[model samples]
Structures are given as structure tokens and as C-alpha cells.
Target chain A: MFTGLSAFPLTPFVDDAVDAAAYAGLIERLAASGVDSITALGSTGSYAYLSLEERSRVARLAVAHAGATPVHVGVGALRTSHVLENVRSAEAAGASGVLLAPMTYQPLTPDDVFQLFATVADATELPVIVYDNPGTTHFTFTTELYGRIAQLPGIASVKVPALPEGDAAASDRMAQIRAALPDHVTVGISGDASAAAGLTAGCDAWYSVIAGTLPEVALRIARAAQSGDRDAALQASAELQPLWNLFSTMGGSLRVTAAIAELLGLVAPRSLPLPILGLTAAQRAEVARVSDELGLGG
Target chain B: MFTGLSAFPLTPFVDDAVDAAAYAGLIERLAASGVDSITALGSTGSYAYLSLEERSRVARLAVAHAGATPVHVGVGALRTSHVLENVRSAEAAGASGVLLAPMTYQPLTPDDVFQLFATVADATELPVIVYDNPGTTHFTFTTELYGRIAQLPGIASVKVPALPEGDAAASDRMAQIRAALPDHVTVGISGDASAAAGLTAGCDAWYSVIAGTLPEVALRIARAAQSGDRDAALQASAELQPLWNLFSTMGGSLRVTAAIAELLGLVAPRSLPLPILGLTAAQRAEVARVSDELGLGG
Candidate 1:
């Protein structure tokens, strides 16, 4: 039931370790800042890199510290068994809900798509959100299938990264999904750069990534959107666009994470196990510069 | 150290369950079939659809029945953690090695790639094979990276699926990798239709999918290559192409798998899991006809 603002927190890391205190501290600050909802272990939260145990721990921390706010845990896995297991664990850890992308597995049919979400939906008491970030997952779900999955029990919302399909088509797709679903099911916008447009078009919520490492700026934009202050929302997105692109340009969970950590004044001691790389020196400076410009720094 | 043939066996399913008896039976037959090695839970095994428990049981059966033949257990997962876990399980099951693909995940760097294989290599005592099936995993390891991964201890070989890309350029790529590594590290051909070319071009081994379901046809192809009979190898490829293309086209893993089961008179049951669809009626018939034409029933 998030309305004003929802923040997907960037996971914190320190030299091959997940920085729980730093992460907890950030979540506490975001909660106190009147952010309506918190998404943990998300793409920004480095869900893919975290071991299942680590993922559950992060979800628990968010639920524990982000008081009164809904804590949405990321729950997509390569295997349906793992996804279901993650959902069960997240619910056990007191997550208000689970947010997941249909990535991590490939070339699945819409029926398989229905089954993946349905497995999680059936496994948990908590409401589920389906994330459709097609770029990383290497495929897309038709709006038609999204409509079908919405009919599944306890599907509270859908989290689709903004498809760069231009305004009219994107707006049309949003309207189609909205019309297909009951009014209670909301649509949240990922890809912070498109938050204002998503809100203007038809999306009910902004799952803000820029808000992740920088809650104040995120709150400003969310409050602006709440007040229908398009200009302010546009300005915030303008400041964020460069930083977002800096991490977003690269296509992996770990890289987005390294960029987020650098934004929050964390650095390379936060190494991912392997097959996931650290940011280059030049790229790190680029992240630093963009974060500074956005005031997303300590 | 295999020079002739390796087989990726089908894990039998009965009543939607991993039929342990049928699996062990199949492995017993395969072990006695004079194959250079045997691969457990590759595509023909419907490896992606299996739960960890099922996968573990299959691996155990393969190792127990393998005799002197090496067993390559498939270990591809969306998350690195699970891949590592699968690798550990494969090692625990006494598998000689694992065949890992960069599937369910994407956009990994050379270093990340190195780390993925290296971590699996380091975690266990077994030699691991790097599976590069771009048609499925979608991530191709460059020769430099392959050479680097080869240097990592326990990496016994590389498994390359032959596509049109398996050309002179591919041969050169193979040669470059071979030049950088020790003679013990073999380059294994995964595409049976391309095995003769790959072997002639200097790959050390060939892992056949068709050979798993149809030992007679597979043995012929392997024997033809062992004796340097290109004409006989090409004849085998002609019959095998329909089956390869049968599964490779349409519906991705599920359709390909359904085709595999249909031909072998095994319990493929239904289509693959979510996100993957079944073959059309005509395609199903094609799978049957190809199987019949190849006289695989014998």
C-alpha cells in the first residue's frame, strides 16, 4: 500500500562482506525519512550476488529496521524451486511482500511464466509483485501474460522496468495492463529515470533506485510527484539520469551494485565472489562524479 | 583425457518423478557401451528442469554406474551461489567432473567468468568442463578467457556446441586455446553433427547428445571419427541433424526435451516448465519421424 514513495535500497558491501550495520543504518534513515516502502535484496540490493542465506538476512534487516513501512524482498531465482524457497524465507523473515523479476531463467513460455509466479504465490502468505526487467533476463513477457498472472491470488502488483518503447506505446501497454487488472493491483515503475513519466502515464508507484542510495533526493521527487509537481520530479530525474546511466549502462547485478556502493561511499573491499567484476578505476570515478552531482554521497 | 566419445545421458522420469531405477539402468547400459565418458544431466537429461534432490540422485546414479568412464554433471544456475552448490553436490556424488554453462545469468566479464569456473574448480577435487552452448547459455567464453580458465586447476576440458560459427575461425579459436593450455586439457565437441570437423580440426574429444538416447547411432559416429572416416562421420551427422534441429528449433528447452523423450520412448511426459512451451503437433511428428528414420528404436 505504498503511495508517496518506495525506495529500492542499494546493498552495502565491504571487502567481500555484506555491510549489515551500514545497510541497517541506511534503511533506518530511509524509514525515518517517511519513505512509504522499502525494497531490499533487489537488483540495486545485489540480490543475485547474495547467497540465499545472505538474501534472507538482508530481507530480515529491512523488515526489522524499516518499521511500519512495507519491506519488499527480491525473490526471483534461476530455478522455480529456489524462487519458491526464497519467497518462503522472505515471508518467514517478516517481509511485507516479495518483488521479483522474471529473469534468471530463459526462453520460458507465458504458461511457464504463470507457473513461476504462481509457485511463489501459492508458497507464501505474503502478496507477490512480478518484476519484468527484460534486458537482464534476456526476454520479455507480453502485456497479455501479465494480465493473466495478475489474476493469480495475492498478486498485489507488478514491477516492470520501463520499456523504452516511446510514450504512446508504453502508455498504451500500461493502460492495457491496468484495464485488465482489478483496481487494487498497482503498477510500480523501476528505472528511476522514467518515474515521472510512468506516474504521468498510468503507473501507481515509483520503485526508486536513485532514492535507494539517496533517500532525501528520492523523497523530494516522490513528494513532488504526490503534489503533482512535474518540474521538480523532472529536475530530480535530470540530476539522477547520469548516475543511473553510469550503472545502468553495464548489464549485470554486480556492476549496478558496485556503482551503488560507490555512491554511498563504499568501495572495492566490497568484492563479489567471482564471474562478477568490480568497476574499473575510470568507471568508479565516473560513478563518483555523477553521484556527487546528484548529491548521492555522504 | 578422452579422445573418442562422451555421452550426456537422459535422466528418466516416471509419473513426473525422477525414476531412480530407470536412470541407474540407463547408466549401466551407457557405461558398458564403450563410450570414452558419460555426461549426466545435460539437456538430453532435461537437467534444467530438475530439483536439487533429483539432480543429486541422478549424479549419484551416474557415478555409481560409470565404472572407469568419467561423469560430467551439469551445473548451470542463475545465481553463482547455486552453481557453486551444485558443483559441490556433483563432487560429493563422486562425479569425475561438472559441465557448467553460463545460463540463467548474463553479462559476466572475463574475470567473473574465470572466477565462476575457478570457484567451482577450487571448491571440489573433480575436474570441471566449461560448457559453451551459446544457443542456450547465451554467453560465449573468448579463447583468451578459455585459456585462462584452463590454467585454473581442475578445469579438465572445454565443451563447445557446434553452430554455423564452428568454422575456420572457430578452429583457429580452438587452436589458440589449445596452444595456451597443457595437452591434458581437452576441447570437447558437443554438437555430434560437427564432431568430425571439430575432431579433425584438433579438438581432443566429442560429447554426443544423440549418442545418449541412441547408443547405436552415437557409437557409429564416434567409431567413424576414431578411425578418421570423414565419410562415415558425415553419414552419421546426416541422420543426427534432424534430431538436433528438432530440439534446437522452437519451444527452446521444453520442446527439445519433449523431442528427446519422444524418440527414446522415455517418459518426457509434457512440455518443459514455465517460460518454455511444447512443440506443435507437426513438430512432434517430425521428432518421431526423425527418430524412426534414424532407427533409434533398436
Candidate 2:
């Protein structure tokens, strides 16, 4: 369930509320796509911007519309109690797994993060993926801390950030992380642009943002790498370099992904939560132009 | 209202609930301590770990019990709408000012942070304090960015983290920040250990975490500096070097302050929110010995 491309969809909004119909459509689309799993309420989903009720509803909606695909729900919150509540909500919503990031305001020590993971792992029956996206959560996990957390019960996966650029370096990085954890915990790669390199470097999964909206394209790269066609995987990713550039320069993937979604008519224009003004009109036009040139929009 | 000693009280918890009796007692104590102001929901108050309802209740309680001392509420949230809601709550609670940290989950751009403060400044009648606590928020503010935000309407104060060790270096740092803002916007200093140096270096306010627990001692330092008695202020701070050393070595001031509160019988033992284990018993006893030696328990 944790292997291959885990598509993370945006939880689109309308008039300051979760656009349930639009969100359900997204899940149904992901369910139709042959990705390994569907992860809802990821950073791409703007989980941090939502209320508890909204998060719970999003979790339930993801499960209900995902069809036969396993759904992993992001259950990160600033408080351990809130994270546990989110985990319970995910469990009740019938999620197959939970992604836990050490969401922080206070600068967290390694022990603080380990304790947070330990507490959640103790409370939940579901498999936990250590969500290590320092870009959003601002809590970096050391390899030693990763080893400590993976030793805890129910930590089934470790979703690491981008790998080093070259294949040898990326592989060396992956090997270092793998040596730190037990064999059962799969290592998944995030950072959409680095997916092909990471996949070719032997990461078990691509925990992806781009795959959520444009599944066929991400699937092309993932399948090529998984089937040992490294050139094809790299080629597929290289074709979408424009989109990756947008993600890097324009703050992060969330707003640009929202722009792409809006362009494709997959979600409402200006669908992101407030304070996150999705993208400038010119930026959206650039995204549309790049996305169209690459035949991303069907 | 933003000058002198602005005490940041801990919102102590017992059995994972906000101990209202203990919190109110803290506010009443600060109110009678001749401190310039009382700031509720600052990092010392554990604002990020609280729910909206709990935060609103704490805001109201601070206003209700602060007597004649002006009360400032930290009205920061991950979402803009939620931050506006907190600002509205503080205004309705009769708070004199609101502290706005660009509390982030998704790393914000300078534009995003500026827009956040602008939006909040527009929405509320209460004056805004630009909370620049990089240690907690993981968002560092540039002097240029400070100039930009201070230009926004209703931004009254800037709560900076810490200053350099030497008096001359701290004074230069203060001058650099002062040059970035308008004449009306006051600069307050946080970081309990740096309060004396910051105050002596011409910071308008000492946003003291220790002051929240031990107002008289903070007042002694703050008053000495404000009255141009720099030697007295430095001497007073030097006398409590043990307490300052504990804060430096023990994660931060919150745990040490909580330990001191527990030792002083100001709040219930083990009062911090879950996942933030206050301190080991040995650490707590160390705080006790230091506080007792400094005559901080009285």
C-alpha cells in the first residue's frame, strides 16, 4: 500500500469552504488513475489551513471516493492531542494509513519529535508514515531520530524530502537512510521534481504532489523507473521541467499545483485557502502555457 | 502601552485543560506588580498548542483580570481568517493590543507575511504588535520587511527575539531596527536572558517571560534601565545569572518558567501541554535552587 506513486490531491475550496463536490471529483479521478495509493490532506491538500471539522470531513471524503485504492491521510497538527484526534478521525473515516509530520511553532528538539511520534504510534492502530517535509513543518528529522522513530511500533514508512542531484549521490543518501531504519519501513520520496532521480536511486515510493492532478504524466515516470527503464523515467520528468521550475520559484508546490488544477478545470479558480493567494494571473497564464506545451491538459 | 515590562504569562494546564484559576491568578499578580502591560497567548503562554475556543477564553480572561494594566493578546494563526477571528476576539474582550506573528505551516513569502499583517491591521480596531520570534515561528524577518510591515496601519510594536551579548553591539542592533520603523512603532525585546541588555540598549519594552512569573525582579531590571540606571539594570540581571543560565541550557524559558511556577505553587505541578514534557525532576530542582538563591520565590 505504501509503495509506488501515492497521488496527493488538493482539497479545493469554494467561498471559504471546502468544495466537497470538487474534492470528491478529485478522489474519484485518483481512484481511476492506477497510482499505488491516494494520500489526502497532504501539504498539497492545505491540511494545516483547515479546521478539525473540515479535516475530518476531508478524510472521510477521501476514503469514500477512493474506490479500491488505499488512502493515507495526513494527521499532522501543532499539538500532540490534536494530532491524535486527527489520527482517530482518519481511522474512523476508514483511512488505510496516517502521515505524521512534526508540525511546529516552538523549535522542536529531536526528543520532542521522537516523543510526538511515539505518543501517536502508541495511540493508533493504523500504520504511520513519518512525513518529513521540512519545507512546511519546519521540523527537520535527523537520521538518528528517524532510526529511533522507525523502531517504534506501527511506523511503516519514512517520507523523506528531496535527494541529492546525481544518481550516485541520491543512491548513497537513500542507502544511508535505509541503513538507519528496519527492513519493514519503506522509504518514500517527496519533492515532485526529484521523483525520477529518487525512484531510479531505489526509493520504494514516490509520495507525489504532481501525480495528484496529472496522474498519467507522473505514472509514466514512476512506471518507467519501477520497471528499470531509468532513461525513460528521467526523460518523462525532464519534459515537465517547466512545471518543476514553477514549484521551486513560486514559494512551493501548493500554489502552483492549485494554479494547474484551476487551469485544467479540476478545481475552482482561486481555490486555495486565504492568506495563500494561489497565483498571480500572469503566473497562472505561464502555468497554463507550460502545462499545455507539455500536453498536460487533456 | 507597549513600553516598560510587558510580562508574558504562561497559560498553565492541568490534566491537559487550561487551568483558568491558575491563569487568572497569574494575571492578577501581574496586574498588581506595576508592570507596564500583560501579554497573554505569547509563546510563553503556549498559544500555538491551544484550540480556538481555548485561545479565546484565555484572551478574555487576560482582559478580565489585568485590572488597570493594559492587556495585549497574541492573535496569530496559520490561516488569515483565523488570525482575523483571534483579533476580533481580542478586540471584543477589550484587549489594548494584539500581537501578530506570521504563524506559518506553509513557509510564507515576504508578500504573504506583509499581506497577513495588512489584512489583520485592516480588520481590527486594536493596535498590532509585529511578533518577530524566529525561534518559535521559524520565520526570520529582515529589516527591510520590518520597514514594510511597520508602514501598515495599526502596527504599534515589534517584539524582537534576542540581542547580541555586548551592550555596544546590542545598541547598534537596536539602532539598525529603529532606523527601519516609524517613530510611533515601539520595539519590545523578548528572550528573558537578553532582557537586561536589550533594555539597557534602548528597547522600549522588555517582553519578559520571567517577568510573567516573577514580576518584581523583572521590574527591578526594567525600571533600572528605563530610568537610565544602566549599571543597576546590568547588575540586577547579573545577579540572576544562574536563572538565565538555566533558561539557556534547558530547552528554553517556558519549561524552566513552568518548573518555577510549579515550585512557587503558582500553578499545578506538570502544567505544560502534552508532548512538551516540562522538565526532568533534576532540572526542576535546579530551577528551584536557582530561583530560591535569587529570592525569586517571594
Candidate 3:
């Protein structure tokens, strides 16, 4: 269930509230796009920006809208008690798994992180995905630490940062992570730009951002790589270079992706939570131009 | 109100709930101890681990128990909206000021941070202290960013990380910060170990952790520094070197401070939020020995 494309959709906001209908629509679209799973409240979903009630509602919404598609809910929070509460909410919402990231305020030591994972894994029956997105959570997971956590009960998979761009580097990175974990634990890649290299170099899953708002493009690349058509996967990913470039220049994927979602009318005009101004009109026009030139408009 | 030793107290928890009586007692202790100010919900207070209700309640408790001592509340959140809400709560609690840290999940840009401060500063009449503790927030603040933020109207102070150890380096660092910020915005120093040096080198305040628990000891140092007695200030800080060492070895200040509070019976045993196993029995023994030897007992 964890070994393929997992689309992470935006929890759009309108007037300081979660746009429930828009969120459900995005989930329903992903469910019909043949993606392997739908991950709600991932970093791209702005989970940290949400309240507990809002997170719970989004979890239920994802489960309700995603017909037959396994849903993994992000349950990362700063406190252990809150993380457990989130895990319970995910379980109550009938989620397939819970993604745990060591969200920190005080810089955490290795033992601090290991203890967090062990505590969560002990409290729930749901499969746990070790979320290792340092770009968002600011906590890096070491392979030794991964080995420690993966040995614990209920740790099913690891969502790692993107592998290196070079095939050898990517293959070596994947091998190191794979060697650190048990056979039952799968390794998935994040960082949308590195998805093709990661998948072609032997990653079991592509935990993608673009897949959330534009699943078909992400799936085209994921499917090619999974079928052992490395060249085809690279070609498909290369086609979206313009979009990737925008992600880099625009200070990360969230704003640029929000712009794309806005352009496609998937969500409201200014959907991002406050203080994260989505993008300037000029930037949005650039994103639109790139989206159009790449034939991404649906 | 932003000068001298501004003690940051731990928001003690008992049985998964905030121990209001214990928290009030800690504030009363600080109020009587001649500390310059009481900062509730700083990193040591576990603000990031708290819910909105708990945070709001803690803010009120600080203001109510502080007697005549000025109270500053840490009003930081992942989203700007939540931050604004916290600001309102702080103001409603009659706090003297609000300490703003760019607590992040998604790594923020300089512009994102600037906009956040601008929006928060514009929304409230309460003075905002720019909290630049990268160790906890993981967001490094450049001098340029500080300069930019200091230009905003309600920015009254900056609580910066420890200055360099050397006298010359400390003076140079403090000079650079003072150069960046306006004269109206005072420069305060965090990192208890570096307090004497920071104050002697020209910091206007010591945003201290140890002061919250052992105000007498911190006062000796702060009073000496404020009176221009550099040697006395250094000697006083050096006397507590054992406690500082324990802070370094025990992951960080929060656990060791929690142990001290427990040892003093200011709060119950196992008072920290879960997954933050306060300290091992052996570590507690070490803290007790150090506290006893330093004559830190009340």
C-alpha cells in the first residue's frame, strides 16, 4: 500500500477558514487519478498551520472523498500527547497510515527523536511512516536513527528527502537507506524535482507534491519509472522542468503549487493561509505561462 | 520593561494539564526576586507543545501572578493568523509586551519573516520583541533582517542568541546588532551561560533561563553587570558553571530546569509535557548535587 505515488493535496483556505468543498474536490480528483495513495495534511497541505479540529475535519474529508484510495494522514505535532491525539483522530477517520515527523522547537537530540517514534508506534495500531522532510520540519533523520526506528514495531515506511540527481548517487543513497531498514519497510522519495531520479534509481514510492494538484503528470513519470522505463521517466520529468524551475525561484513548492492550483481553479483565488502571500501577480503569470507552455492546463 | 534580567519560567504541567497553582507560584517567586521581567511561554515554557487554550491560560496566569513585575508573553505560532490570535490574548491578559519568534514548519524566507513581523506589529499596539533564538526556532536571523524588522513600529527589543565567548568578539557582535537596530529597540541576550559576557559587553538585558528557577543567583550576576562591575558579574556567572555544564550535557536547558523545579518542589515530579521525559533518576541526582553544591537551594 505504501509503494507508489502518494498525492498530497492542498487544504485550501478562504477568509481564514478551511475551504471544505474545495478540499473534497481535490481529494476526489486524486482518488480517480489512479495514484497509489492520497496523503492529506502533508507539508504541502499546510498541516502545521491548522488547528486540531481543522486537522480532524480534513482527515475525515480525505477519507470520505478518496474512494478506494488508501489515505495516509500527517500526525506530526510538537508535543507527544498532541501527536498521539492526531494519530487517534487519523485512526478514527479510517486512515490507512499515519505519517510522523519529529516537529521540533527546542533542537532535539537523536534519543529525543527515537523516543518520539517509539512512543507513537507503541500507542497506535496504524502503520507509521517516518517523515524525513528536513526542508519543512527542520529535523534531519540519520540512517543509523532510521535503522533504530525501523526496527521498532509498526514502523512501515520512510518518506525521505529526494535522492541525489546523478543515477549512481541516487542508487547509492537508496541502497544505504534500504540496507538500514527491514524488508517490510519501504522507502519513498519527496522533493518533486527529484522524483524521477529517485524512482528510476530504485525507490519503492514517489511521495509527490505535484501529484496533489496535477496527479496525471506525476503519475506519467511514476508509471514509467516503475515499469523499468528509466529513459521514459526522465523524459517525462524533464518536460516539467519549467514547473520545477518555478518551484526553485519561487522559494519552494507550496507557493508555486498554490499558484498552479489557483490558475486551474482547483481552489480559491488567494487560498494560502495568511502571512504566506501565495505569489505576486507577475509571479502567478509566469507560473501560468510555464503551465500553459508545458500543456499542464486541464 | 525590556531591560535587566528577564526570567523565562517553565510552564509546569501536572497529569497532562497545566498546573496553574504551581505556575502562579513560580511567577510570584520571580516577582519577589527582583528580576527585571517575567517572560511566559518562551521556549523553556514549552509554548510550541501547548494548545491555544493552554497558551492563553498560561498568559493570563503570568500576568495575574506577576504582581508589579512586567510580564512578556511569547506569542509565536506556525501560522501568522494564530500568531495574531496569540497577540490578542497577550494584550487581553495585560502583558507588557509580546515576544515574537518565527516558529516554522516550512523553512521560511527572509521576506516571509519580515511580512510576519510587519503584520503582527501593525495589528497590535503592544511592543513586539523580535525573538532570534535559532537553536529553538531553527530560523537564523541575519543582521540585515534584524535591521529591516527593527524599522517596524512596535518592535521594542531583540532577544538574540549568545554572543561570542571572547570579550572582544562579544563586544563586536553586540556592536553590530546595536548598529543594525534603532536606539529605541533594546538588545537583550539569551543563553544563560553567556549572560555576564553579554551584559558586560553592552547588552541591555539578559533573557535568561536560569533566572526563572534561581533568581537570586541570576540577580547577583545581573546586578553586578548593571552596576558596571564586570569582574563581579563574571565571577558570579562562573560560580554557576556547574549548572551551565549540566545544561549543555542534558540535551538543553528545559530538562535540567524541569529537574531543578521538581527538586525544589516548585512543581510535581514528571511535570514536563510527554515524550519529553524530563530526566533520568541519575541525571536528576546530578542536578540535585550541583544545585546543593552551588547553594542554589532556597
Candidate No. with top lDDT? 3
Best by DockQ: 2
User: Candidate 2 lDDT, tens digit per residue, B175-251?
Assistant: 99999999999999888787888988889998889999999989989999999999999999889889889988998
- Expressed as tens digits, the lDDT of each residue in B195-258 for candidate 3 is 8999999999999998888899899999999999999999999988999999999988999999
TM-score of each: 0.86, 0.96, 0.96
Lowest lDDT sum, 10 consecutive residues, model 1 chain B, at B268-277
Candidate order (lDDT): 3, 2, 1
Q: Number of clashes in every candidate structure? A: 9, 0, 0
- When summed lDDT is taken over every stretch of 10 residues in candidate 2 chain A, the lowest stretch is A104-113
Of candidates 2 and 1, the better by lDDT: 2
lDDT by candidate, in order shown: 0.72, 0.90, 0.92
Instruction: For residues A54-124, write the lDDT of model 2, one tens digit per residue.
Output: 99999999999999999999999988889988998999999999998888876677877899999999998
Q: Rank candidates by TM-score, best first.
A: 2, 3, 1
Residue A212 lDDT (model 2): 93
Model 2 in CAPRI terms: which quality?
medium
- Flag the better candidate by lDDT, 1 or 3: 3
Q: Which scores greater on DockQ, model 2 or model 3?
A: 2
Per-residue alpha-carbon lDDT of candidate 1 for residues B1-298, written as tens digits (9 for 90 to 100): 4556888776765545677776776777778887878889887676776766778888888899888887889987655667877787898888777888876354676666677777778887777888887766667678777788888888888887663454677678676777877778888887666776776666778877766656666788777867878678767766667666665575443455455655565544553443344565677777777767766677
